[model samples]
Target chain A: MEKVMAFTGDEIAAEAMRQINPDVLAAYPITPQTETVQKFSEFVAEGRVSTDMIRVESEHSAMSACVGAAAAGARAMTATSANGLALMWEIIYIAASYRLPIVMPVVNRALSGPINIHCDHSDSMGARDSGWIQLYSENCQEVYDNLIQALPIGEDRNVLLPVMVCFDGFIISHGTEGVAVLEDKVARNFIGEFKNIHSLLDIDNPVTYGPLDLFDYYFEHKRQQVEAMEKAPEVVKKVGKQFGELTGRFYGLLEDYHLQDADLVVIAAGSTAGTVKATVDELREEGVRAGLLKIRTFRPFPQKEIIQKLSKAKAVAVMDRSASFGAIGGPIFLEVRSALFEEQKKPLVISYIYGLGGRDTGINQIKQVYHDLAKAAQSGKVSQLVNYLGVRE
Target chain B: MKLKGWKDIPWGGLILEAGNAQKYETGGWRTFRPIWHEDKCKQCLFCWIYCPDGSVIVEDKKVKGFYYEHCKGCGICAQECPFEAITMEEESKFRKDQGGRP
Candidate 1:
């Protein structure tokens, strides 16, 4: 029987991992992400799940172990946040290169300097092009749903790639919300059995993995990875449909909210989308035409769908919690602008960088954005292409 | 074997054919080639024991000519031959088929 439980994003992620019962889980703990692996470890100790829990020394070793286990034909998984994700950067690429379907839950946190352990997009955005499917969650429920769906999306024959499920640190990761938890049997049946390809442990037909490709074949292999990423969206769609059939919650590359007919639109991902959604409703009730495009899948970045969604709007605002430094706006903003470049008539798009290092982004700020949009819509121009939110000027 | 294109090659650069690395003639890297003298004294089999790459051909408890295909010309066998039965010769001296010196 399906039941609703009040769970923090971290706790829900642990619950989902427990349901999947990955053959091996190799992880190093970091804050926000720590409670997840900690709770899963308790499950391991209690004999609730039969997963081989590898307590790796660091995030690098954690990913390395997951890569090894996955290559050896075990269903492998890991969870990390912030500096831990940064440390695993190198092997994260290797795991994708090897076409290993390891699903990792990354509790989004700021990259360090004047160190702060708070929520931001910098960590995952830094790894946007590392050849893994990235899923962004707006709430604890999406966090659970995304994690449950990751295995099938990645293990598809045409899309043998790793996946990273990202949610805001402290915001979603620490905050508790009501999530409808699927029964263990239903969850198991949804994922089905694991079928690996060209595993290292297939002793009958010996194979060599991670071979020295050199100039002769390295480019060709990279092309193969590109093809895999190209094939991922359709597979993600199919899996999402199947998951929705089992449960009642459907998923897609991006969540369309009040976007059908609107002059002003806001494109945002992660927990901030919920804020945008609430603010969009408020604007609509107050007789303002406002809508939101909540990004769910950020990697196989839904370019065509995004263009169709925002093409007719007078103006669009992309909310990025991470700074891009030298680039024009942040990561999502750059992509949205680039996607619009293909349209003959497109929205006047701008960037709003907000919520870095766990800064509070409230309803008033979102409302202020719509007010700015009202002015920009009438004036046919934006004063600034890039604006920082929840920060003093 | 023919070289493969991007689409023709296996995904992830996997080598499905196991132990096929032997086909690549690494002896091409050799600068000095070893000449084994069968007429000279002892067949102590020490060369067979010391040859790196298993290039020393062993038949019925006796040493035969070097395989030459895999020999890296390390001269470890020549150094181990107490009877001075092996000689290291300059590789570029011979033709491609080991005929007369160029």
Candidate 2:
């Protein structure tokens, strides 16, 4: 009952845009993300999808245009990469504070200093606490599938925050993989139509969109934001269930591969998670009780689920493609530690920074992480809380 | 314990009647003013460099003056002075000629 086609992840994203058929498409061109906008531009050229693609000057304007469009009661989609995301950071917070359900596909890449155009999670990591729901994709399939899932999760009545789908740049964005795209009618029916509960463009009912709140009411508004975020897990679970029913593919806040009855576990996110799973499979063949915990949603962090999963393991290795300088560990590591703090028996969690600056992290390094985790579990003490897995110097 | 007359209320015990008024004071506030000690001032221009609102003025390797009208009282110039020359003080006592509203 589904239409299947052999498509790459980028093509899948482009076709997903066609299927979703947003009213406004605003994004700037950046590496590893250029293909998506190109394909979308072609879609606009061919008259297949009727939407207004605004070519903005900068990523800030791209997000500003998206805020305007979303406030105008339109379903909008945008694509960006590392530096572009950094430029749009201010407006990204504004979008979330305004509670606009704008969906953005972030081609995850390393933030620049020396300059690298490779896959990493640093871009999304820097924007972690910006009040948007972040969803990480492990493969080309999830990249396509999660984009479809993000709409329902974000547009739910209770949780009306923006959603960002992050896929590893060049790895999943550029790498070719087989993907199945459902028909436009099917996706449209699945995601339904955009109903604006509060729109800025409605002249019949006069209302204010975003007004400055004084000190007396500021805390209550922020508390309301937290309340909306706390309510997102229910929407995420419901949308995951509906997407599974429709697409026959299941998604969770955290997807486990052989995590049950495992002595050691390696937690990862983004495309590198696939490598971790592959290495886990090989280690299992050799009688190593190693498992993989692929994190899907990072924000509105599934803290309860993570605490339950990792509390039972002997040792856990958290692999982050980003760094939090001067902290005890990375951002994900900090959250995981806090989540497991209330539990009686907490696993020895060590944060490992890898795949930074676009360096490819193969299965060998993942095996090394597992080996180090096993050693630490055996000794019952962490030699290093944060380990740089493979670095030139 | 059960008296229910209007004069028995707590607020009704006051000596003044309801429409009676008393004089009010409106001179409790004052704006900040920056003063530079000429003896300790070396004219290093650090105050000019550090002022957030560009309220300080330095000319010809000497302290010329500063504009206190638009100063936000952020204390950046006073904190950043190398010689601790700038000190903040209340502008002056309120007077009718000094534009007191009341």
Best by DockQ: 1
Who wins the lDDT comparison?
A: 1
lDDT of 1 by residue, A227-269 (tens): 9988998998999999888887888898888999989999999
Q: Report, for candidate 1, the interface RMSD.
A: 0.8
The top-ranked prediction according to TM-score is 1
Cα displacement (Å) at residue B20, model 2: 35
Per-residue lDDT for A94-200 in model 2, tens only? 88877788999999988887798888888999999898999999878888899998998998878888999999888888888778677777888988999765666
Q: List the residue pairs that clash in candidate 2.
A: none
- DockQ, candidate 2, vs. native dimer: 0.02
| Candidate 1 chain A worst ten-residue window by lDDT | A190-199
Error at B67, model 2, angstroms: 32
Interface RMSD for each of the candidates: 0.8, 20.4
